[model samples]
Target: MRQAPSERGIDPHLHRDITELIEGLEFEHQEQERATAEVSWYKEHTLFFSLV
Candidate 1:
Protein backbone atom coordinates (compact mmCIF):
# COMPACT_ATOMS: atom_id res chain seq x y z
CA MET A 1 0.00 0.00 0.00
CA ARG A 2 1.22 3.49 -0.75
CA GLN A 3 1.57 5.72 2.29
CA ALA A 4 0.48 9.30 2.13
CA PRO A 5 2.82 12.18 2.92
CA SER A 6 3.42 12.66 6.63
CA GLU A 7 5.87 15.56 6.54
CA ARG A 8 5.90 19.26 5.80
CA GLY A 9 5.82 19.29 2.02
CA ILE A 10 3.38 20.14 -0.76
CA ASP A 11 1.34 17.15 -1.89
CA PRO A 12 -0.18 17.60 -5.33
CA HIS A 13 -3.52 16.04 -4.46
CA LEU A 14 -3.86 18.00 -1.25
CA HIS A 15 -2.80 21.20 -2.96
CA ARG A 16 -5.38 20.72 -5.67
CA ASP A 17 -8.14 19.99 -3.18
CA ILE A 18 -7.32 23.01 -1.04
CA THR A 19 -7.15 25.25 -4.09
CA GLU A 20 -10.57 24.06 -5.25
CA LEU A 21 -12.09 24.60 -1.80
CA ILE A 22 -10.70 28.14 -1.61
CA GLU A 23 -12.09 28.95 -5.04
CA GLY A 24 -15.49 27.58 -4.08
CA LEU A 25 -15.56 29.62 -0.91
CA GLU A 26 -14.59 32.77 -2.80
CA PHE A 27 -17.34 32.20 -5.35
CA GLU A 28 -19.87 31.71 -2.60
CA HIS A 29 -18.72 34.88 -0.88
CA GLN A 30 -19.15 36.86 -4.06
CA GLU A 31 -22.65 35.45 -4.56
CA GLN A 32 -23.59 36.37 -1.03
CA GLU A 33 -22.33 39.91 -1.55
CA ARG A 34 -24.38 40.26 -4.72
CA ALA A 35 -27.52 38.98 -3.03
CA THR A 36 -26.98 41.33 -0.12
CA ALA A 37 -26.53 44.31 -2.43
CA GLU A 38 -29.70 43.41 -4.32
CA VAL A 39 -31.68 43.11 -1.13
CA SER A 40 -30.36 46.41 0.14
CA TRP A 41 -31.28 48.17 -3.06
CA TYR A 42 -34.76 46.69 -2.99
CA LYS A 43 -35.31 47.74 0.57
CA GLU A 44 -34.14 51.28 -0.07
CA HIS A 45 -36.41 51.64 -3.05
CA THR A 46 -39.32 50.14 -1.25
CA LEU A 47 -38.90 52.53 1.65
CA PHE A 48 -38.57 55.53 -0.61
CA PHE A 49 -41.64 54.59 -2.62
CA SER A 50 -43.65 53.98 0.49
CA LEU A 51 -42.96 57.52 1.73
CA VAL A 52 -43.78 59.16 -1.60
Candidate 2:
Protein backbone atom coordinates (compact mmCIF):
# COMPACT_ATOMS: atom_id res chain seq x y z
CA MET A 1 0.00 0.00 0.00
CA ARG A 2 3.08 2.26 0.01
CA GLN A 3 3.61 4.91 -2.67
CA ALA A 4 6.45 7.40 -3.38
CA PRO A 5 10.14 7.29 -2.47
CA SER A 6 9.58 8.37 1.11
CA GLU A 7 7.44 5.32 1.63
CA ARG A 8 8.94 2.05 2.85
CA GLY A 9 10.50 -0.31 0.23
CA ILE A 10 10.14 2.14 -2.67
CA ASP A 11 12.79 2.04 -5.42
CA PRO A 12 14.50 5.34 -6.21
CA HIS A 13 14.36 4.76 -9.96
CA LEU A 14 10.69 3.99 -9.82
CA HIS A 15 10.07 7.13 -7.82
CA ARG A 16 12.01 9.23 -10.31
CA ASP A 17 10.07 7.74 -13.21
CA ILE A 18 6.78 8.38 -11.53
CA THR A 19 7.77 11.95 -10.71
CA GLU A 20 8.78 12.59 -14.31
CA LEU A 21 5.54 11.13 -15.61
CA ILE A 22 3.49 13.26 -13.27
CA GLU A 23 5.40 16.38 -14.23
CA GLY A 24 4.91 15.65 -17.91
CA LEU A 25 1.23 15.14 -17.43
CA GLU A 26 0.95 18.38 -15.47
CA PHE A 27 2.77 20.30 -18.18
CA GLU A 28 0.47 18.85 -20.81
CA HIS A 29 -2.57 19.78 -18.78
CA GLN A 30 -1.40 23.37 -18.40
CA GLU A 31 -0.81 23.63 -22.13
CA GLN A 32 -4.27 22.31 -22.85
CA GLU A 33 -5.85 24.75 -20.43
CA ARG A 34 -4.01 27.67 -22.02
CA ALA A 35 -5.11 26.61 -25.49
CA THR A 36 -8.70 26.27 -24.37
CA ALA A 37 -8.67 29.71 -22.79
CA GLU A 38 -7.23 31.22 -25.93
CA VAL A 39 -9.91 29.58 -28.05
CA SER A 40 -12.63 30.77 -25.71
CA TRP A 41 -11.31 34.33 -25.78
CA TYR A 42 -11.16 34.28 -29.58
CA LYS A 43 -14.70 32.99 -29.83
CA GLU A 44 -16.02 35.64 -27.48
CA HIS A 45 -14.27 38.44 -29.36
CA THR A 46 -15.42 37.12 -32.71
CA LEU A 47 -19.00 37.01 -31.53
CA PHE A 48 -18.86 40.50 -30.05
CA PHE A 49 -17.42 41.95 -33.26
CA SER A 50 -20.01 40.17 -35.37
CA LEU A 51 -22.77 41.75 -33.28
CA VAL A 52 -21.25 45.25 -33.45
For model 1, give the 10-residue run with minimal summed lDDT. 43-52
What's the lDDT for candidate 2?
Answer: 0.65
The local lDDT score (0 to 100) that residue 36 gets in candidate 2 is: 64
After the best TM-score superposition of candidate 2, give how far the Cα of residue 52 lies from its true spot, in angstroms: 46
lDDT of 2 by residue, 1-52 (tens): 6577566666889989999899977976666666668765543224221121
Please give, for residues 1-52, the per-residue lDDT of candidate 1 as tens digits.
Answer: 7656675578889899999999977976666666668765543224221121
Candidate 1: stretches off by over 4 Å? 1-8, 40-52
Question: TM-score, each model?
Answer: 0.58, 0.58
In terms of lDDT, the best-performing candidate is: 1
Name model 2 segments beyond 4 Å from true: 1-7, 40-52
List clashing residue pairs in candidate 1: none
